[model samples]
Each structure stands twice: as C-alpha cells, then as structure tokens.
Target: AYEYTLKAEKVCEEGTQKQIPLYDHYFFSILICAEVFKLDSSFHDQAKKIAYKNLKNLKKVQTQMPKNFRSRYLLAKAVIKMNFSPNLKKEISFDFLSVIGVANEDNYLHIEGIACEIYGRFLKDKGIHLDGAHYLKRALGLYERWGANFKVQAIANEISNIQNDDFNKEININSFIEISESLSNERDLEVIFKNILETAITFSNSLKGAIFRRDHNQYFVISNVNNDISHYPQSIIDYAYNSNQIVRIDSIFDLEDFSKDKYFTNNQVRSLLALPLVANGEVESVLYLENSKVDKVFTADKTRILEIISTQMALSIKNAYLFKNLEKLVSERTEELEKKTHQLQISSGEKQTLIRVLCHDLANLLMSSRISFKRLNKKLKELELSDPDITRYLKKIDSSFTNQSHVIDNVRHLELAKEKGFQITLTTVDFLKTLTNSIDTFEQQISTKKINIVINENLNDIEVLSDELCLGVNILNNLISNAIKFTFEGGKISFGLQDDDQEYYYIYIKDSGIGMKDQMVRNMFQDNIHTSTRGTNSEPGSGFGLSIIKSYVNKMNGDISVTSKHKDDFPEESGTTFILKLKKAV
Candidate 1:
C-alpha cells in the first residue's frame, strides 16, 4: 500500500494535472495505509514517518485546494501527527477541530468520520474510555451515513476493545495498589524477596517461582517457592537479564532449537517466564516463574502485569538493603555509647568520694581553729594588754578564718546539690521568717560595711512552697551576703514583697552598690563562667553562688532573674536587683 501511494504521488507531481483531484488519490491511499498500519505495533513507526513526510509536502500547497480536499488533507495530517506525538493533545485537538469545522461547512461525511475515529483513539490511549467510546460511536454513525461499511465495522470493533480494556485495566490497577501497600513497610530483605516471589507466583497462576538477585556479573537465588535454584531455566533467565526484557515461553516446543534440551523436554515443565527487574537503568534482579500444569499460563496480559510488579520489586529490594545497613550502623553506635557511659560513671564516683572526704576533714579543722582563736582572745582581754594594733591583727585573722570557712562550705554545698538522686523537698514555709533569718546571718558584714538594711513593711507572714534549706541557706544567705559585700559604706539595701494575684508571688531584693557590668549579669548564673568580683572591703567568694541558686530554684519549680547596672553605666542609680518568683502555698 505504501509503495502504491508513493507511485501515485510521483505521477501527480510529474503530470500537467497536478491539482486537487489528482493528489486526492495519493492522499487517500496514504491515509488508508496510516490507519491500517497504526493498529499493528510492527508497522506503526514506518507508517507515521511516511505519512508525516508526505503531509509536510502537501502543507505547502494545501491552501490552493478546494474545501473538501483541504479538510480531508487536514484529517490525514492530524492522524499521522497523533501517531508521532500521542501526548500532544492540544495540538492534535486543534487540528481535529479545524478539519471538523471545514467538513461541517462542506458536508464532508468521510472526512468527519475519519477525524472522529482518530480523536477517539487518542482519547482511549489516555484512559478516557467513556469519552473515547462516545467519539467512537459518533464516528460509527458518521461512517454508516457515508455508506462506508468497513469503517463502520472497524469503529464497532474499536468500541468493543475499549470496553474489554477498561475492565482489565480496573482489575490491574486494584491489584497493583494492593501489592504496593503490602510491600511498602517491609524492611527485611529476606522477607521482601519471599513476598515478591509469592505474589508473582499467585498473580501469574504459576506452580513455582524463584527470585534471583544479581551482583555485578553473578546471579544468586534470593528467594524460592516450591522450586530449587537449579530447577529454573538458566538460559531464559540469562536472556532476560542481559537483554533487560521479559522472556515468556508458552510451551517447550515454542523454543524451536532448544525444545529438545533436558530442561524444556521435561513433561512436568510446560510454561516458563523470566522477568528482569531494572532499577536506576540497571538490571538489579530477575524473577523466574514456571507452570507445570498449564502449557500457556503466561499470557500477554499476565506478562504486562508481571513487568509492572518487577519495577516495584526492584525499589523494595533496594530499600530493604539500605534499611539493613542503617540498622547495623545504629546498633554499633548504641553499643559504643553504653561503653562510654559505664566508664564515665566509674570516674564520677571516684571523684565524688574524694571531694566528700576533703570537705569533712577541712570542716573539723576549721572548727578547732575557731575554738582556739576565741580562747586566745579571751586570754588577751584577761591580761588587760589591749594594744590597738593587736586588736586589729586579731580582727584580720578572724576575717581570714571566716573567708576560708565560706569557701569550704560553698564547695561542699555545690557538691551535695549535684549528687545523683539528690532531690529538694518542697513544703509550705514562712517566707518572712526565711528572709529575716538570712538577713540576721549577714548582720555582721552589714554592720562592718555600715550598710542600712531596710526590710519592706509588706513582708508579712506569707507562706510559699519551698525547700527551707535551699531557700534560706543556699539562696537567701548568698544574696544578702552579696548585697552587703558590694554596697558602699552606709549604702542602702531594701527588700520588697509583691503579690500580683497570680499563682506565684515575687520577691525583690535591691541594693545601692557598685553594680555589675552587662557581661557579668549575663554570665552570673552560668556554672562555667567566673562572675565573682572583690567586695568593697575586698571580701572574697566562690563564683558558683549564683549557679547553686539557679539549680535549686529550678528543682523547686521556681524562677529567678537579675537586673543590674554598673557604676560606670549609671553613676547615681547603680545597683543590682535579684527577683525570685516562688509558688504561693495553696
């Protein structure tokens, strides 16, 4: 048919009557060839190329033709273009509509029928079965009207094929969805391979199946069901793997030359199928299925379904391999962490014991020294030899002892707070009493600095949820002592209590003193920073006082914050205010 069309086109080009009617025979022949060849996969490509080349040539002289000829020419052009680029729906639709418009105006039934048939096929290819069937029926009616019995019968067959295809597609889609869901969460490679082989066997209605995985050039059995690795046809498997295509044999006799081979000649082995699972453009594995009972079990439809399953199986196998590796890495890391944690526990226990011994021994020695110093002061007073310098030296000695005691106590308390399983016992406590006791503890330092302590009148017998030892000794004592140490001579330290009708009450401790810098305030409560500065009288301190305060406050479920301005930053109003928000006793 293609050769005849070419011969007719050549004659039309050569003769003096190279006009519409002469070219009609060539185009009509070419159109029929395109339509017939498009139904067969073997000739589909050649048909498109031939039709496209001739239509492109016809396009140059198409405008000179009459309406009927131009419309027929357009219908043939659209059909060929659709074969070349089936996905170009918009361009194809516009071309079909243009042909139909001219056909309607000129009453060209044949041209319209052909346009509707091509449009219906395009829609059917895209899975629009209902709409495609509508157009197919329309074309069938138009062909009947134009007295083309063959085209009418062809359109009727197309509609029947669409109905069958739609049903098969629906079943295929549901099966794929179920298979995908079943394999989505499978992480074990052995389990994944087993499931894939079993599913392939069931779906293909095969008696036995095996999945062979490829590593470089080697193929090994990963999973098998009712079959051994040696039982599968190696030649079929090799062909599918090497060619990256599905190989199916309905019967041993179909192998032709290999039909007499031992594997194929066996009476028990009738049908064989080998499918290559390709991932990332590489053949990763091959699935082999055999049906001993049925000769032609692996049909074309079954082969297509198995091919789609092969794609999903490839991804599942890859993911399972990755998950296995990730699980191994996590196990190794967890074991290493456990070893390091054990070593750290031993080291920490040894350190804690050493600290406790030192604190205990040093506290007893300091107590003995204090007793001896008091006895000596008494003896000197009894002798009535009160030299002015002697009194001053004794005072300085006492101050040194006091500073050493404070350092030792701060270290001991900090160690206790950090001890494992240590917990603060919160209970209802008198807030006013705690404040007063803390103030009394720092009375000697306040007197030496001559700082006036102004207790707020609103500080009544208010109760708060707190640990008494943490609140009084660790928190309040450190804050009051700091106020006295930093205040200038005769400076004022004020305490204010506030109730804002909330779940917690606020306590404000403000002092008029040489306040802190921005950097000092920022790092004051951080355990890693050294924020301690010498007092107005050069009194010393352990830098962890605020750190201990913060830790205990957090344990008691309270909050603490500080606001300070250095004397350099604010000359007149330079002081630090520490605010504590403690829960009110219910």
Candidate 2:
C-alpha cells in the first residue's frame, strides 16, 4: 500500500493539476497512518497538526472530490488511524461503510480493502478476538500484494499491539493448570459465565454488566451485578436475535432511530452491546453487557477482553451439554442391560431343571433296554433249533440291538461337543461340490418324504476356509433336513454364496417352508427350543440342529439371519429367507 501511496507523493511533489483530487486524499490518508503503523507517538504532536491541516484541505475540495475515484481506500485508511484514537474516535463515529460510500461507484478495491479493515477492527474492538488477528494478518498480505503499503503497515501495527496484549494477559503454565482445576467446581454454565464476566468487568474497571439468554418461549436474564432486567420486553430480545451479531450502541442519540420500538425506548439505557453466544457449532443464547452511565461506547480493549472470555464461555457450555447427554445415555443403557441380565439368569435355572429330567428318563430307559436284550438272547440260545421260528426270533433281537447303538452314537456326538472346545480344523475346499454332497447324503430321508431337493444355480466358483470334513457336512445336514422336514414335497430349497471386496462370502440357504413368527425368530437360538409345527408328513425333529449351527458359526466368525413371510399376509411371496455370511478363502 505504501508503494501506491509513494506514487501519490510523487504526484504531489510535481504539483500535477490533473491528479490533485486523488493525490491529495491519498497523501493525507497516508500521512495520518505514517505514525500509528510507522510514525511513533513521539511525533504525535507534529502528526496531529499535519492531520488537522489535511482535514481542512480535504473539506475545501469535498464538493469537487472525484466521484469516479475509489473513496473507500481513503476511508479505510482513515478508520485505521482513528480506530484506537482517543480524540479522532470521538470526532468521527462513522465506520468503514460510512467512509467507503462517500466514493461514487466503480471503485471496488478501495471498498473491499476498507471492508476487511472494519470487520477486523470491529472484532478487536468488541472482544471477539478469535480469528481477528489472523484475519488482519491475511488482509495485510493482500494489501501488500496490491502494493498498498500504507494499509499493510497499519494492519501489522495492530497485530503487534494485540500480540503484546496477549502476552501480558497470558497466565503462567502452572497457574493456568491450577485455575483449570478450580473451574471443575464451577459446573453450572450460567454461573460460570456470570462469575467470569463479573470478574472481567471488575478487573477492566468497568461499571455494572448484565448477560441474557434466549430460551424457547422465554428470555432468561441469567447474569447481572445489582438487580434483574427479566421484566424487559421481548422487542429488545427480538432485535438482538434478528441481527444475529454483535451490536454496540454507545449513545442514546445513535439509537433514537429505534425510539418507535417498545424495548429500547423504555430501557433508559445509555451504552449497550449484544453478542451472540456460540457453542458446539450451535447458537444456544445471546450475551450482552450494558453500562447506564460514564462511557458512551465499548472500547477496543473491552472488546478484546470479552473475546477471550467468550471462548471459555463456549467451552463451559459445550462441556455441560456433553456431560448431561452422557449421563442420560449411560443411565438408559445400564437399565436395559440389567433387565437382560436378569432374564438370562432365570433362563439358566430353567435349563438346569430340564437337563435333570432328561438325564433321569434316559437312565431308566437304558437299564430296561439292557435287561430285555439279555433275556431275548438267552431265549434264542435255549431254542437251539435251525427252524424258521428260531431265525425270526434272532432277527428281532439283532434289529433291537442295532437301534439301541444308533441312539447311543447320536447322544455321544452331541455330548462330546458339549465337553470339548469346538475345534475347527479349516482347509481349502470346493464350496459348491461339498454342499451338493451333503444334500445327497440326506436323500434317503428326503425321498421318504418325497421332497424335491434343488441345487438351483451355482453362483460362482467360491472357495471358503472351513472344516470341510466336519462343518460343511454338519451345517448343510441340519439346514437341508430342516427344509425337507418342514416344506411340502415340491417346496424349493436354494443355496448360494457371493464374493466381494472384503475377501469374504455370503452363504445363503433359503427354503419355501413354514415361516416363523416374530417370537419364534428370537427364540430360535435357544437350546432344545423349536417353535414351528410338524411337517406335511408329520415328521419329528430334535430342534438341536439350529443351536449347534449358531455355535459353529460363532467359532468361524460368520453371521446368519432369516427373513420369512406368510401367504396369508402376502399371497405371492411366501418363502423364508436365510442368509449366512462367511469369509472367503485366500
């Protein structure tokens, strides 16, 4: 900006008649700024005299000021010099807009540069320090790039002063940590803000300050020094909310335009400031402070202090909300878990009782069967004849013995699984071929029921890491048997698995059978529990198959789900959907 201003200096030295209007404004603007950014206050007297002389010169040419020239550039420079001015601030209450609008249309650079300075200055003046210093630093770079050295230096000076203030305001690391610990006792959000604001005002040597929050359907007067303003009308709150920004009115005459309004006309307030309180990306309330007398407006220093306090205010509010939410969620989840734990304990007791009954019945039946077999064998030996009658008696005895052994083998298989950890010995296996083989092994029973077993279609050549010799046979044996037992002779049974990005597979086996009710689905995993009725042929099942399937699936880190429908509800779509998720082989 100085580089551009230096060009104007050359024009002034030459006394160029054509460029007089532009050169003079540019010169006076730069001369005023030469100190705040560069000229030390040691020359404040000399600089002030020069400023007063330029002001008179500017007034003489005010009517002839080039309407086409960008006036904002000059206005922004003026604001920069007067921003912290004890006297200039009192003289010119106009902001960047007031200065920039003085120029006619077609001067955008001046307007934009001046706008940036105002926004930065406004934040610094009001205690909204967050992003202010950084914003100014960035604007300085832009002006430097635009070759506006005057604006650049002004911005740099502001930053330097702010940084110094920040340094002085900072607490020692140990003290900061101690203060943080003390804040823990200060939990309620409103109380925290009230204390912080009251303390800040006292330290800054300011008179009474008040804070307000807009709750739904009510404006809650949260913080104050002497008394309450809760009786204040809604119109005042509405103006603050409508603006959604920080508004400072230092003089009553400045707010005379709002006299028609009910709240402002009656408040009898002299100086006021309203700033929106933001926390956790949401605007929960408004924060404002007012002084009835003494100062006409909030100073830049006061605004800086407030900006620092606003950060603490936001953090406290956010922490309070999170703490409240976490407490509620934890309480709800704990109650649900406690209810489920109680149900599980009751179920465990019932399972113990059922096991005792089954154990007693099995012991009595085994003893009776053993005694009958011994007597039958002895009778057959006594006959000792090679006749057809002897042969028939021996055949009956042999058949009875074979049936007893089959029952014992089945019970032993299930019991051994209960004793040993479910050890899975996985190997590379052809998934489709193994599945078909298991279904064929069950053909005898399926044929007796006259049920159709469909391979349907092979989805793709998929390999899975599994215990082919055991799990494949076990999983399919249970699934196909259940399907044939429940489904009619012509019912469909289909199996498929697809591969995807995770090097995993989804193994599905669906059957057109008697679909389950919602209650039955939840209970399907229970040991010795099956809710559906018998098949079309009145076949009986143990219901232990599904319980074992789930256990094996857990061992393999796979998942399964079922979806079912009833023709009575939906006529055309009536089959059950069983889906299983499995990892694919490498």
Candidate 3:
C-alpha cells in the first residue's frame, strides 16, 4: 500500500493532476510505516525517518480536512516520537493521551486500538509490564470489535506473556477506578478543575492550591481561594510554566538566594510546589500548591503520582473541549434540520427524531464510560499488580459495558423498524458460516453453562436467502440466547439443516432443557401476548424478542415455528425446538 501510494504521489508530482490532494494517502503511508517500526526493530531507523517526513507533509495540509483527522495525525506523531524520537519522551504521554481522548470521543476504534497497542508496547519496553498488559488487553478488545482477528490474536499472545510474571503489588483498585470515572464522566471544565485541585491537595498534603491556565500568552488563575494571583507566589509558577517542569521547595526562607525575592521574603510559607500540565506539545496549565506550616510536603512518591494526575487532568480537559465543540455542532445541525423539516415532522417522524437524538446521546455516554474503564485499566497496570481477582472483576465490568452496547444496537434496530417497517435485503448468505458466527457470539454464556452444541452435519456449501444483520444479530442470535437461557447446566443444544422442498430449506435448533406449555408456545410470537418466562437461573427478558424475530423472518419471506413439551408432562424428553424455513439461494 505504501509503495503504491508513493508511486501515485510521484506521478501526481510529475504533473498528471497538478496539486492532487493526497494527504489521506500520505496519512495512511505514515501509519503503515509506523506499524512496521513498532513490530520490527530492524526497520526502526528507516521507518521512523519515512513516517516523520510524511507527518511533516500531513501537518502542512491538516487544515484542509475535518478536525477529526487531527486525532489520526496526533497518533502518527506519537508513534514516531515513542519509537524514534527519544529526546521527546516528556511529550510522549501527552501525545498518546490526546490521541486516545479524541479517538474515543469520535468513536474511532481502529485508531484507538493502534494508540493503545503502541502505548502498551512503549510501557512494556520501559519494564512496566503490568500496565503494558492492561493497554494490550484494551487494544485486543478494540481490534476484536474492528474485526482485525490477526491483530487480536497477536495482542492476546502479548498480554499472556506480560501477565505470566509474578507481580503482586497491593493497590486500591476501586479508589483509582472511581477517580478515573469521576474525571471522565464530567464535561464541565470548572467542575473538572475543582476536582483536580481538590484531589491534588488531599493527596499531596497541601494547605491550599490554585490552577493557572495558559491562554494565548497570558495565564488565567483558578483557585479554591480568591482568584487573586497575589495570594500565591508567581515566581515558582512562572518557572514551572516556562520550563514545563515541576519545582518543589522544602523551605522558601532556607534558600539564601531567595532572601532578596519579595514574595519569598515576605511570606511565611514553608513548602511550595509548582507543576506544569502539558498536553499536545504545549503547557496547558500550572498547578501551584503550598504548605504554610509543614516542610517538604511534596515527597518523591507523592510527586510521581501527582504527575500522573496532571496527565489525567490534561486528557480530561482536552476531551471536555472536544465534547463542547461536538455539542455545538450537533446543536447547529439540529437547528438546521428543525427549520428544513418543520412541515414534514409528523407524529411518527417526531418519535423517530426523538429516538435518533436519544441514540446519539446514549452512544456518547457509553463511549465516555468505556474510556473511563480504559483509564482505570491503565492505572491498575501502572501499579504493577497482577491479581487474578482484579482481572476477573475488570472482565465483569467489561462484560456489563458490552451488554449496554448490545442494548443500544437493539434500540437502533427498533428505530429502523419504525421507519422502514421491518425492511430487509435478502442476500445469499452461507448458512453454516452465519450460524457458527452467531453461536460464537454466545460463547461465554455457553461455556459458563457447560452446554454441549451439536451440529448434525456439515452444511458449509449451503446458502440461504436472508439479511446478514437480521439473521446474525437479530434472529439467530436471539434464538441461541433463548436456548442458552432455558438450558440447564451440562445440557445439549443441537442444530440440524435439511432441504424439505426444492424452494425452501429448514434449520432447526433443539435444546434439551425445561420446555413451555403447548398453548404458550403457540402464542409466543404474538405481539400482544407476553410469553416470556424466567429461565432456570431466573433470567429476565423484555418479552419483545420473539415478536421482533417474527417480524424479521416475515420480512425475509421465511416461516418460523416452535414445538415443545412441558418438563412436568414429559420428564424423560422435555425440550423446545424452533424450526425456520427460508428460500434456498441458487
């Protein structure tokens, strides 16, 4: 891809198109070379130089594209700086944080995955395997969703190796996760600043604190006390802000050189520190802290943690700004739509509009929560602790978020049904392949219940006419879930495929578990009838899955039926079987 793009660039430079817009191609070339640099150490030197030149070219024409592309550009910058430009180590964290924040905000999974993977590798090379593993695992999840199976396998292998080490550092996982979630959930800038100051004061044992944000060439002060800049010494703040470093003083009066300085001479302060918050290669803010009575309040370990907090603050601030801008854009778009479609907005259209708005907002909220989880995972890794219990808890948390995502998908599909009336495009889908993937979606649940899945025969060559999304996510997925829900531990769920006639094929799923009454099974797909029953484990349902499945099946010109005998009536062979008949694609 890189070579072909480079050839195209040369051809365009030779006057075929005269000033062709190849920035996107250049951006991709940078990414390809950057990945090569990451995977192969031998290509580091050449890859870095090539990627760096492309980055410079990208920067020149960045304004011609949408602001979202800035995240990708920053990612490329982080890759080059992390692997090749060692002198810019101080700026590496900021670059990665900004890239991640923007990528998460924009829902750019691939970009986020690449950033996390490279960041993980960077941490691993620094001997922080625990944190590296956390990032690699995050990258693994993102890649899996992006359908990059090869990359997912590679990252999983990397995470396994990292976790093999015996790391048992004690950490307060709940507290850190809470802090990260609090910061990530809030988009109000003032609230975030207050939280940052309060957390910094409490953790660092400071009497009072203030934050000064750099704007243009001036600094604006925000403090727990009065907004007076004179309340705190400006000299240390200036030094930290100008130099982009932390300044810690044990005692102001102890330094002989400071005796002439008016603020140090006049004040009774004992300990003071000024730390700069840098993001995207610039100083964003300065956090000034003081202890009037105590000496040496800011210790090394405290400072180290505070530095990490500063990085978090920078990321939160940038993300908040991004969200603010996006909200403005959304408001503008909504206003335009309202004006243009005012006459056409009927009752159904109004409901659809509301659903669209809610879906968009809910998606943003879910993304924010996921970002907080990633941050917490990163912090846990930073602690160098490798506890199985913590990992298990994290997985549970991740699973819950994934469930929320599925709910969002179902809601979106509901909106689609409302608008299109259960419309579906029938395509020739491989019957066995689709069924296998659908079953794999419930792999965790299946494994948990120790259920055996049996396929009657190989139907790899068979194809059926159906909508892929409807068949995979909506129909087959829901049916499989229902089977797993009612199926007892160590039960069996079997699948069989057959051609009942020249025009149609039959697919049957049978589960050997508790079955419903015949009358209830007959009315299962009725819209007004509530046929949902608690599973063996008392699992709850929305009572709408069957009706939706029936609608989708009818839309695809298919038929579905169920047969079952109650466990009380037939003790030896009580089970439920669902038979679906669809057209056999030629």
Top candidate on lDDT is: 3
| Model 1, C-alpha of 581: deviation from truth (Å) | 1.4
Predictions in order: lDDT:
0.71, 0.56, 0.73
Instruction: Rank candidates by lDDT, best first.
Output: 3, 1, 2
* TM-score attained by model 2: 0.31
Candidate 2 residue-wise lDDT, 401-507, digit = tens? 45444444434455445556556677777778878767765655677666665554655577777777555545666677777776767777777753345866777
Off by over 4 Å in 3: 1-365, 369-422
RMSD of 1: 31.6
Give the per-residue lDDT digits (tens) of candidate 3, residues 82-184.
7677557569978988888889888989989989988888877776555666677678779989999999778766654553444322124444444444454
Clashing pairs in 1: none
Q: What are the TM-scores, per candidate, against the unseen true structure? A: 0.34, 0.31, 0.39
Clashing pairs in 3: 131-381
